[model samples]
Target: MLQTEFPFTLPCGYVDARGNLHRQGTMRLATALDEIEPLQDARVRANEAYLTILVLSRVVTRLGDLHPVDVRVIEGLFSADLAYLQRLYVQINEVGTTLFETQCPRCGLRFSLDLTEGGDINDASAGL
Candidate 1:
């Protein structure tokens, strides 16, 4: 089955107006509509940047103590944090569950790694 939920930490983090820092969160995999629906928003048409804001808002289920993640939270993210989310979105939606697989040259044992949680084998912690 396709893994649906993904966890991540922001590079710079999002600081709310209350001064609370939101660094960790869970982002669910985007469906076709999750990506396509934003293109129809007037704000997205007016300012292309809002497309990502909307898309991220829809996929991010939680961030730190914040409940019911919203567009306001996405709009408040730092540029670095935004970039991290964008990368993660692509990684989850495009690259997918199996990041890579190989067989040990010496032992000849095959193994595969699933990155749907937070990261791939390249950087299991994927602090990016």
Candidate 2:
């Protein structure tokens, strides 16, 4: 059976308090309860945008040199990394597959990008 979790690299990476650069991490697919429970958090309720940080902390299990990921870790991530993980969370859980459709407005080209374990995000050109 394939693992429901997937590994990813932060676009800008995270820097710990000790100045260690942490880039690689794993995120598991979100369950209904996972999405629902965060809504009850006072922090998430106070800052709607903070929901992403909360959601991410729950799914991200590990990061470079960080055996046990925590909320503070997610809170310390760079904005670019936060965005990347948000997209990744959607890609893995809600998108429901390893491939997604993309388009280039300049050329009116629509293509499918593979998001599987070994595929690259920019490696897409298949016609639907």
RMSD (Å) per prediction: 8.0, 6.9
lDDT of each: 0.77, 0.78
Model 1 bad stretches (over 4 Å): 95-97, 100-120, 123-128
* Residue-level lDDT tens digits of model 1 in 68-115: 799988888888889878877877788533553333457744444554
What is the number of backbone collisions in each predicted candidate, taken in the order shown?
0, 0
At residue 59, candidate 2 shows an lDDT of 89
Could you give candidate 2's per-residue lDDT for residues 26-104 as a string of tens digits? 8888888878899999998899998888888888989997967889999998888888788778877875576654545
